[model samples]
Target: MAELRLEELTAQTIVAARNLALKPGQAAFIAPETYVHVEQDLDPAGSWPRVVMDGDHLVGYVMGAFDADATEDFLKAALWRVHVEADAQGAGVGRFAVQALADEARRRGFDRLTVVWASGEAGPEEFFKAVGFEVVGETPYGENLGALAL
Candidate 1:
């Protein structure tokens, strides 16, 4: 297995992160543009956006939140968005990235990590479940809400 790492998203990596592309049929799950827009809108105090790296190569991107003061309905440490590049999917990159996010949440004193994905999407529900998340509920927008107790 390759060593998977998460690097803090910085000005130097933003362009590469924004250029990551999802596989066919996967775009409905999340958009790269959303990651860029969210990164722009949320101050560093409210979000931690990271570039997923395999060795020195940028392979994906993920955004998470640790802000206990967040006014949004999501109170726990949540994985706001994650996307593995089209070429890197199914090589355990997604698994490693989620596990890394969970580890980060644990480091922040969080006991759980929450994520929401489009319920109607094909792959995400199974991918999340395979990584130890359980379907807990549905978001008001009908997304599948899941939790992993770290």
Candidate 2:
């Protein structure tokens, strides 16, 4: 029962969480591609969100960004590069993190939030469904786009 908190991801924490992600086979993360943009993204919109700390240990990371530029009336949000350390995976931390992100999205007046999970990693799809996301579509190589109305 670890209580979760949302914190900006420091460069150090990004590396730590990246290391954690790399250790697990088949659990690849988009972080390797997008982490460099964190500070800039956070600065502009205050929404390159990350979650940190499980009693002072960094257990995971998530980034949520809005797609206001899209023509769709509902504000689009993307939940990216999310991964929890192996030991913390089944301990409810992921769910808590999702809830936190959803809370943030709602606060920001987003109409919907989407989690694009790397495919064949059905665990996340199940996790998303558990927390109220509906499958909108799939991406190549089995990645999925799941959405939740805020």
Minimum summed lDDT over a 10-residue window in model 2 is located at 31-40
- Residue-level lDDT of model 1, residues 88-125, one tens digit each, is 98898888888888898899888889877775445587
TM-score, predicted candidate 2 vs. hidden true structure: 0.74
lDDT of each: 0.76, 0.66
Give the TM-score of each candidate: 0.83, 0.74
> What is the C-alpha local distance difference test score of candidate 2?
0.66
Supply the TM-score for candidate 1.
Answer: 0.83
Model 1 clashing residue pairs (backbone) = none
Please write out the lDDT profile of model 2 over residues 28-145, one tens digit for every residue.
Answer: 4443233333324432463575866887888877767665664432225667556777777777777777777888878878878876665444346577788888888764435556
